[model samples]
Target chain A: MIIEIVSWAAVGLILVTSTVMLIIHDWRINLGALALQYVAAFWLVTRHLPFVMGSTKLITGWMVVAALGMTRLSLSSEEDDTEPSSLLRGGWFRIILMCIVALVTAGVTTRIEAIIPGLGLPVIAGGILLIGAGVVHLGVTSEILRVIIGLLTLLTGFEILYAAVESSTLVAGLLSVISLGLGLAGSYLLLAGTSPPELENEL
Target chain B: MSAPILWIAIPFISGFIILSFLRERISPLIAGSVALILALTALIIPIDTALLLGSVSIKISPSIQFFGRSFTLTTADGTILALIYGLSAIWFFGTEASGTANRFVSLGLMIVALLTASIAVEPFLFAALLLEMAAMLVIPLLVPPYQKPGRGVVRFLIYQTLAMPFILFSGWMLAGVEASPGDINTTIQAGTMLGLGFAFLLGVFPLYNWIPMLTEESPPYVVGFLLWAFPTFTVIFGLGFLDRYTWLRTSPQLSGAIQIAGLFMVASGGIFAALQKHVGRMMGYAAIAETGLLMLAMGLQSSEMLNVTFLLIIPRGLELCVWALALSIIKPKVTSLKFNDVQGIARSYPFAVTAIILAHLSMTGFPLLAGFPPRLALWQEIAGQSLSISFWIFLGMLGLILAATRTLAVFVMANENKIWQRNESWTQLIMLGLGVIGLFTLGLFPQILQQFLVNLPALFNHLGQ
Candidate 1:
């Protein structure tokens, strides 16, 4: 009973972190929320996947966060200037979007459950919430960092749902590789976007 | 030796070696040679059969096991392997002439290997992940290092990545459908997911905004290679799905849906192509229209679909290679590829200009060009199905023809007093010259491809049968 409660709590944590990710523009806070989101996702995934396989998601997610953070640290202040002037700038609109996402997710949870039966309500709800929040995040921002974050979030949500459907070790490994590849690609794009034109031909 | 190891593993490893160690100037030649050899081997050596070479006996096995998954490359896969790597060789060989040799060859080889693996992998659902990996590899190639990535490349990544979950989810749902074939609800859901997944991957209609944007931002040669590679493999992968599932192929509504989707893409792509002032963007639209033709081919009766599709695909690669190479040769001389920027370019680079116009017309299905015969065959087939479908396709072709005419006019719009000069390098001329000759040869004798096209359908088991 306590395990069920804890899993439900993890689902709740996913909801908060993903919503925070959608609204927050600061890279550090967004990355933190993404890390926490993955932790919660890992917790839920363990209910379906083995502990080791589920942990790959958490490890890959944190490594992605680390890679992006390192890349962020290496950037000049001008290059790192995606931070909003005010915390509330468009934050409220995003909050409103999150609210709509939450309501729609609530409405669709049962139908998704009906389609992929044996996926518990909490898993379905959590997965749908992340997907909704990710889409909203992607729709709202075109910033490189933000787009990468949104894609990672969307894939995480998918991983959570897919973990229940497939348990192949090879699939798990391939998915982890994909997550890492996205991180590396994101880092490359971030650096390349900020570099001077003279340096373009060097690579 | 195993087929997968020979085709997939060797090229993959060679790509890495070339990237890590080889000089940029020599990489294209070596990579092209390797690809050509692989293509020839696939064409000549039958899998699962022993061959006596001089005194030694050799056998290439059909399948290999890795991490509990199977990758089987049978004799039926030879045509596909030959087609993919042969076309890849052409692209790689022209990279030097196109001036993308430094960035294209190694990565191009790796991308081809991954795509080949996508075709060979079992449980075929794994093909989605392989394709995603290939898409990721394309980013570095398309965007030069330390350059600001354009919205086109980013959106390309997002859209391609977005396709994975849809396809995988549909694959899982399909497992259920396979067991309970009568379950309409699950079938509908799975089919919808599959359709949406492919619509995104194939860049059908609305999802294709990134294609033209990509053309504007990246080098035309790299974009051209991508345009050729991605859709060709995806169409094959999608054909695998239809071949495996009885209901998906048999459903008339599904076929109609595919035809409608093709019609929308063709009509929209053609209209956009005609309206575009930018030559590069116009090429992108023309590609989208050609892909729509592939989809229309897929909607035909199973007996004729494979033949028409192969005929269409063979010419597409040749046409894109010529067009892209011509554009690359001209790009350095012009301010931009927009109509205004490139007006009167033919006065300087006559050969390149002529090649571009001819390639564009071929794609527009001009008579006595490579793209004409398959298009003629397609028109007759679609007309037999529904005259309205044929009419819309014809209208699309007309739009393309108009675009080609406009492009020709821009090329020739020089001052009357200007002297015609051969500004293109000898290498560029030779390459373009050969490509032009190829277009005419294929167009004049479409029967040249008959031998390979006869066996190409064998790639799909149930569909071929």
Candidate 2:
């Protein structure tokens, strides 16, 4: 009974963190939220997988976040030091807009249980929120880095739900590989605008 | 020896090797030769048949197991693999001409291998993961050095990633549907999920806006390779779904949905292409229209669906290569790809202009070109189903033809006072000429392809029974 309560609590935290991640413009805080979101997802996935195995998702997700963070650090300029007011340049209006999106996502998840039943409430709700937030992120921004985050968030949601449906070692490993690859590719794309030091030296 | 090992792993390993040690002056030549040799080996090496060469016997197995998954490349796949690698060789060889040879050849080869593995993997739900991986690999290739990633590339990644969960979820639901075949609600839910999944995968209708944007931002050749490789394999993957599900194959509503979706893509792509100011964006619409044509063929749900689809496939690769190569040649001379930017280019680049026009005409299904015969067959099939659909499809083709004519006018606008010149290298001229001849030869005698396509439908033994 306590485990159930704890799991649901973790899920609730995940939902809040993912929503915040989607709502915020600060890269560091967003990455922090993303890492917490993955850790919370790890709690839910542990129901399906062994602790060590389920923990793989958290480890790999953090690794990805770290890779993204390093990329941001290397690529950040002086102007980026200022805290942006809102996620979108439009400010509070976009925040309210995303809040409405959150409400709609909650509504959609509540209804989705009718079609795809038998999953735990926390898993379903959390997964849907992650997916919904990810979509909103993608739809909201065209920035390559943010778009990559959105994709990663979306995949994390899918992975969490997929663990409940099927558990294959190969798939788990493949998904991990995909997450890592996304990180590297995202970093590459994020930095593609700048010439490498070697290239500059050669020139 | 295993066929999957030869077709999948060898190319992938070779790709890595080239990227590691051989990405030099001769990389394109090496990559092209390797792909060509692999294509030939795939063509000649029969699955499960022993070849006796001077008292030595060798046989390639049909299937291989790796890391608990099975990859089977049956004899039927020989031709498909041959076609894939052969077409891929065309792209790799042209890499030098396009001047993105280093990474394009390596990444292109790896992408092909992964896509092929996606098709071959048993318990095919795994293909979604492989496809997502391939899509990720495309990013570095598409985003050039010292340039920011464009909206098209980001959207492409998001949309492609978006497809995975739907497909994976559908696979889960489909298993339930299979277990309880009598459950109507379950069947409907599964079908909806599957439809949505494939819609995202195939970039159906409104979801396809990124296609043109990517074409506009990236080198036309790379975009062309992506257009050819991704959709062709994805269609094959969709066919696998249809083959496995009797209810899915036999459902009239599903077939109707496909036709409606297909018509929407064709009609919209055509109308938009007709109004497009940029030639690169026009190719994007053309791709969407071709996808619609494939969906139309599949909607026929007839035994000949595979045959018609394969026919479309072969020529599409050739035509896209020609068009992209032309665009890449013309690209260096333009500041932008808008029709206005390309005015009077024919005076400087006549061969490229000719290739671009010929390729566009072929794509528009002009007579005596490679895209015509299959398109004719497709029109007949759709007409048999609904004359309205046939009319809309024809309108779409007509729009493309108009766009092609407009582009041709722009290309030829500069040459009234000056004599025309062929600025293309010998390699470009030879390849373009060969592509043009291949297009006409295939159009005039499509029978040469019939034998290869005849047995493809049999791959789905459970479908159309």
- Best candidate, lDDT-wise? 1
**lDDT by residue (tens digit), candidate 2, A17-96:** 76677667778888888888888889888877778878998899999999999988896586354445544555465566
In model 2 chain B, which range of ten residues has the least summed lDDT?
B456-465
Show the colliding residue pairs in model 1: none
- CA displacement after TM-score superposition, residue B341 of candidate 1 (Å): 0.8
Cα lDDT of model 2 by residue, B1-465, tens digit: 898888889889988998888845688788888889988887787777999999999999989987677888888788888889999998888877765648888888999999999988888888988999999999988887667778898888878888888888898888888889999988888899888888988899889989999999998999999999999999889889888877888889999999899999988988899999999999999989998988888888676777888889999999999899889988977999898899988888888888888888888899999999999988877777789999999999999999998998888888468887778888888777777888888888989887668667556667534
Worst 10 residues of 1 chain A by lDDT: A78-87
TM-score of chain A of each: 0.93, 0.85
lDDT of 1 by residue, B95-164 (tens): 9999884758998999999999999998998899999999999988878775678999999999999999
Q: What share of the true interface contacts does candidate 1 keep?
A: 0.61
In order of listing, the candidates' clash counts read: 0, 1
- The TM-score obtained by model 2 is 0.95
